[model samples]
Target: VIRGFSNSRNPEKTIRAYIQMLKTGFSPDHMTYPFLLKSLSRLLNRKLGGCLHSSVVKTGFVWDLFICNSLLHMYGTFRDRASARKLFDEMPFKNLVSWNSILDGYAKCGDVVSARQVFDDMNERDVVSWSSMVDGYVKSGEYNEALEIFDQMMSVSSSKANEVTMVSVLCACAHLGALNRGKKVHRYILDEHLPLTVILQTSLIDMYAKCGSIGDAWGVFCRASVKESDVLMWNAMIGGLASHGFIRESLQLFHKMQESEIDPDEITFLCLLAACSHGGLVKEAWHLFASLKESRAEPTSEHYACMVDVLSRAGLVKDAYDFISEMPIKPSGSMLGALLNGCINHGNLELAETVGKKLIELQPHNDGRYVGLANVYAINKRFGAARSMREAMEKKGVKKIAGHSIIELDGTPHRFIAHDKTHFDSEKIYALLHLLGTWMDLNVNNDDSDDYHCVCS
Candidate 1:
């Protein structure tokens, strides 16, 4: 009965069964602990897991490899890496599962250095080991490192890359906008005849869309089997179209999605709101915002932020301000920043000052707020106040974050900062820029000829 309860999907029943077993004076055996540990992990009941650990030690099952591994996994799931590692070190004999569990614990805790150390120390590795390392790097925003590891896995590792590995690689490609590499992965998938699972197809669409290949994204969406396609696939395509400025197409897709039996989730509305903001559909945005409640989905900060952007961009700054004032949740920095930007654009200095003060209070350490406020003051010829804002930022020790841009070339991402000359081809790049500047000056001179003639006449 305890085994049945533990193996069942319901965690509450599992805990209740354990309680009943305890009341009946039935001490659980070694075989019983793994499934119970799994239930504790699923429930995220760390306190209960600790109690179970104590009981396991009392019963002399702590040395049991299966029980220890399960305990390690549970601690990892709880983000208690120290405890997991302690258990790992105490093990008399370690297997592949034991090593993988500890490595996963470190990875899940964002301890990439420790995970790498474990990976390097491992005598033998399976596909899971490689996938964990790659996925860890991907999660930690080390896309380049993740790709490099994947290359090593392909060239050196005997274990073949699986769907999990492909998913993480595709996610990295999407984030880096590495269309060249993403396309290569897609081609590899085709060459291998790997099943186009829902997740794989969704990631493919997202990768293409984010990489600015809307056409390829659409192709993948169209080719997906209807039976296999789900709401996430539809959301990805809609979001892709909207982000690429095909707002009308995105709206049409949203309507089609509504016609389907699948109900829209928060993400669907987020995409719809983004489409409305980009298309400047003020009326449509309001309607969609109202429809979110009808769908029984609460408005998240991102949803509100999008609405604020839509209103602000439409020159409805006052209305947006009122909306923020009446929001059930407190306004986030991005929402206020959007309104502040609109004020700067529309030359509404008064509202700009108001929003600027709120923004500073909310994000006192953010250098962008001070800079933006200074720009607003300068635009209004309030030179003293603008200088004061900068002085205040310096006093507060807030340094402006240097802006940078990324461009992918030949499947590698290159990052550049303003006035930076660190690239190997900096001299050649500067030469090309100088030539472009001369060409621009020549065009300006040509356009000024008519003005010169009028002055002479």
Candidate 2:
């Protein structure tokens, strides 16, 4: 009964069954403790789990591999890496599951370096070990590292890359915008005859969309839709189309999803709202927001922010401000930032300054916030105010972060930052820029048309 309850949703019932068994004088042996430990892990009741650990020790089941592994998993879930590592070191013998649990603990904590150390130290590894490490790197935003590890896994490990591995690798590809590499991964999936599970489909759509291969994304979406479509797949397709400026297609897909009786989730609405924002479709945005309100999905802060962006982008900065003022919850940094952007774009300097201060206050450490406000003032020729803003930022020890851009060329990413001189040909690059600037000045001024000579920059 304990095992049955534990395997199902209700950990509380699992505990009750265990208590009832104890009252009936049934001692928990090796067979029973693993389930009980699983229950505690699900409940995340550290107090209860600790007490049960003591009881297990007293009951002489501490040496049981299954129970110990369950304990390790429980600790890993708790993100108590130190405690989990201590327990791992104390174990007389460990198995594959044991090592994976400890490695996952480090991964969950975003300590991918430690996870790699553990990975290197492993005598043997399976898909789980490789997937955990790859996923850790992905979660930590170490996209290059994730891909490097995946390459090593493919070259060395006989264990097949599972759905989890593909998802993580595809996520890495998406972040890097490595279209060529993403295509390779897609081909690999096809060659391996990997099942296009819902999650894998979502990752594929997301990868193609972010890599600017919206046509490919649409193709995948269309193919996936031939089967009984899930909400996640629908959400991914909608978001992909929406982000790529295919507002009409995204809306059509939403309607198609509704026709299939597939309910939209929060992310679904967010994607649609983003689509509307991109197209500056104010009426469409409001309609979707109204629908979101009528449906079971409560509007979150991100939704509110997206609405603000929609209004702002359409030159309704004041309306966006009023809408934020009427929100049930306090405006988030992003919510206010959208309003500030709108104010700046619409030339409402007074409101821009006010919203900018609020945004900076909400996110003091956000370098962009300080820079945004200062740039607004500088653009408006409010030199004193702009200088003051910069001074205040310096006073607060908030250094403006150097802005950078990355472009992937021939499957390699090149990053350029402000004042960066790290590249081997940086000197030549700066010389070319100087030549271009001189050419632009002479040609732009010598233009016959007066309008052509009136350059804003």
Candidate 3:
């Protein structure tokens, strides 16, 4: 009964059943604990999991490998790495499952650095360990590192990479625009003639789309062959098409998806809404945005922000204002900033000022909103307004947050800040930027696009 309940994806029911078991005096044993922990992990019930940990310790079975492994898994699910590491350190014996659980915890926590360190330390690694690390790197958005690991693992052991490894590698390659790497992986699958499961096929299509090779993406999609694919597969194709400026095709596919009886999820609408935004289809975007409820999807803060962005980009300043005013959920800082940015882009100082104030109310510590408002004033030649904003920030003890972008060279990431003098090549980079600025000033003057440089409006 505990196993049955734990296996259930409904977290509330799972937790309830476990509590019932405890009430009945069926002290959860080693076999019982993993399921309870798993359920707690699935529900992200950290408090309940901590209670369970105490129960295990009181039972004097904290050293049991299976229970410890389950505890590690629970910690991993919630990214409680400190607890997971302590548990790992105290394990009487470490097995493949044990190591994998800890590695999975680090990976899911977005600490790929720690996960890779664990992978390197493990004396005996099975396919699960390698696959977990690869998956972690992919989720961490380190596609190049994921690919490198895949290569190294293959060289060490000739075991064919599994669907999990392939998925991460494909996703990473697509994100990095490594068309050649994507093509090579696709061909490897073809040459080896690995069974094209639904999962693998979806990854293949997504890879092609992300790599900007729509032709290849379509070929994989056509080969899906099933009369009805999963909604996620449809979403991938739709999103991919929309990504490359094929907004009409994306909408057509959405229509076909409905006709084929594949029910859309919240993610589907999010993608569709984004496509509408990029293509300036304000009417269609509004229709689908309002239709989310009918599809049994609630509008998250992200969905609301996307709508604001879409309306703003299309220059529907009044409509965008109304949309925010009537938003079902409280406007988040990002959503308000999106509107403020759009106002800045369209030279609507009034709207920018209004939205900028709301944004400051929502996020007091954030310096970005203040900077954005100042930039809008600068664009409008309202230098006094801009100066007042700066003064207000100074009075409030708010400092402008330094901007930084990261670059990776030779497998090492380097961070650069505006006018930074910290990098090894700082002198050279600064000189180059200065030279470029001088060239731009010499050849181009007072371009309106400069106002729209990073402003969404």
Residue 24 lDDT, candidate 3, scale 0-100: 84
Tens-place lDDT per residue, model 2, 1-457, is 9889999977889999999999999999899988988998889999988899899899998989998999999888888888899899999999999999999889988999889899999998999999999999999999989999999999989999989999999999999999999999999999999999888988999999999999998888888854566888888889988888889999999999998889998999999999999999999999999999999999999999999999998889989999999989899888888888888888998889889889888998898898889988998899998888788888989887788887787786678898889987688878877877987878866867666332222
TM-score of 3: 0.79
Task: Return the top candidate by TM-score.
Answer: 1
lDDT of each: 0.91, 0.90, 0.84
Tens digits of per-residue lDDT, candidate 1, 180-259, equal 99999999888888888999999999999999999999999999887778989999999999999999999999888777
Evaluated at residue 404, the lDDT of candidate 2 is: 87
Better of 2 and 3 by lDDT: 2
TM-score of each: 0.95, 0.92, 0.79
Worst 10 residues of 2 by lDDT: 448-457
